[model samples]
Target: MNDDGRRTTRMRDRAAGAAVMEQVVRLHAQAPPRSTLARALGARPIGEDTAPWFAGALGEREVGAVLDRLPEGWSVFHAIPVGTRPDASGAVSDVDHIVVGPAGVFVVNTKHHRGQRVWVGERAVLVAGQKQPYLRNSDLEASRVRGVLAQAGIAAPVTGVVALVGTKEVTVRQQPRRVLVLRAEQLVRWLTRRPAVLDAATIADVARLFDDPATWRPVDSSADTVERFAVIEREVRTAQLVRAGWMLAVALGAVAVALPVVSVLTR
Candidate 1:
């Protein structure tokens, strides 16, 4: 609702992982039966179906946290539902994060490759020696954002960014022609350093357009989505801690037995 008493749907301000979080929640609900014994032994309760989305949700949250610290004059929107997928299934695709500031608009694609090596070349991205289509995908995402703004009678420069999270190494052989690649931790600094490209009024106008839900595809989100995810995340973390404790106990017990045997043999 608005001051005009007209119905309205404003985009969620803190929708960093809303898309992936929905996938995680849905897949978790549909996961096949798991062994109760394995769960008791501290195995992760989430099956393979939901594991990737869970990780993705965490990655977006991390990147969102970094973006949240952006200085004044910058605005960011996350998990923006965009155009439909090319597969013709009518499935909507989403942009991980959209940032509007004095510098320019940025369409950020977040890749969460925890502890993996990432190498970016002029035309390709390799994660742990496996080639990925991140470069091509980012370019298309930026183009879509530009089209959306143009439709709103706004002309702006939109840049594509691939924000890698928790990677062991990010070696850029060469910068991509269309997209910027960097570690998530460096995103805010890089963005802020760019020269001012839009004035305050223009920035506000662009942000207002972005804030309107009609600018993007429709998304189904609940107010309690973040809360539900927090519950699941806590469960996963507790299981990991329990597993680590058991491993430590086993190692210590083996060492304790080995010490007496070693002492007897030495005597």
Candidate 2:
């Protein structure tokens, strides 16, 4: 086929991807709380409410600071999805913040943990006191974003950085590897030091890359993945409630059985 036909195909693919992704998002949103998960383990909820926030309040604040200093024409993409499929991985890595500046696309992961000693690796972030599985989550996100933009016919460099936000007690134990790990204060200064490789023209062109925000969505094939998981969750809850009611009924029966015995003994 001609150029237009190829472009149309890509557009349709992206749209379908986006639609399926939305369904995945909804299922995740309806997920059980950590407290509920804890209860499954015979534990209580440690915190007040269970809605999860990876960045939390302070992470959001510091990111805002970094965004405030960016060049005027630069566009900031907050919580942009980059998965080839829907349903982002992990609690926090899914919606990375991307700042499209004149130089390149900057993919940022904001960490909001305080009093944590962080060891930044080439592809992993060690948080609090434990090392997690290594993966260049930010880089992968940047790559996916580039792919999306490429389909729109724009080629540009994408860079990944992790910004530590609200970490007043954070200490870096080692030098950063391929990734640039810094606090929000440092990130602003670093971004301002150099002009972007992609200026106004390039940023604009890349922005228009794909017009399909719908189509092969997050919920397509992935819908079952989330739905099955949800069914499992609901079943667990139902089982718990059923078990609790049974126990209550048994307790009432015991009370009834003992009542006459107790009255006769007393008389």
Candidate 3:
């Protein structure tokens, strides 16, 4: 997915959809409608020229739905912008998902493709006639996420996960190491599974950080791209109120004591 798509995916976390998501919702409502649009923006639609784009939307919706089901406390972060790292050609990568918590940091790659055959092996996800090197990329992503967290002064283990969305047929030959494969329905369980390495305190800390929108990032997860404007409108009017209430009381006490002393001196 492109950058705009990633932003739409994160918007879903707010239980709110952007213009593109609204368009998709409208498309869903209208049947006998432009089936072509569905092909272009939904899950894999056969013979659809923009199946890739539609599949991407489906992937974001699926992944977002799964992450949403987690209990209120579990912090789920998507499409984080890590600092940067060099690739084989010395190009730095901007990885996809970063789930940071006590269970550990997880790097996730969301794949939305439809086909009759699919297999996830040691280093590749084979779907129909093509293959995506998920293992290698996910490992690299995990390393990058770890490095980013380290820069934040937090030491934690990192894992990789692949979230697949699409109505396409899928079959796996073997489970890949350090990677959790999941569909939309199984997201919470997949995420909340006992960690192999991270301690509990660190996990809670990671979750806490994600709940704050201050550090949240916006990125595209769907194929349909859009111009981005990162504006957050908050209603909270936080100020130094009750925290200074004690000081006000202290000043009043001083005035009360000084008044009596001054009256006696003047008289």
Question: What lDDT tens digits, residue by residue, belong to model 1 across residues 54-158?
Answer: 999999999999999999899999988886553332235889999999999999999999999999999999999999999999999999989988988987899
Q: Which candidate is the best by TM-score?
A: 1
Model 3 compared with the native: what TM-score? 0.54
Model 1, position 197, has a per-residue lDDT of 93
Instruction: Tell me the TM-score of each prediction against the true structure.
Output: 0.92, 0.54, 0.54
Candidate 1, 267: how far from true, in Å?
Answer: 0.6
Q: How does each model score on lDDT?
A: 0.87, 0.55, 0.53
Question: In model 1, where do residues sit more than 4 Å from their true spots?
Answer: 1-9, 32-36, 85-91
Order of all candidates by lDDT, from best down to worst?
1, 2, 3
State how far residue 228 of model 1 sits from its true place (Å): 1.2
12-72 in candidate 2: lDDT tens per residue? Answer: 1222112223333444456655556555543322122221232243364457556767767
Per-residue error (Å), model 2, residue 35: 16
Error of 1 at 35 (Å): 5.3
lDDT of 3 by residue, 80-128 (tens): 5443444443322434455554466766677766544567665567778
lDDT of 3: 0.53
Q: Give the distance in Å from residue 149's predicted Cα in candidate 1 to where it truly belongs.
A: 0.8
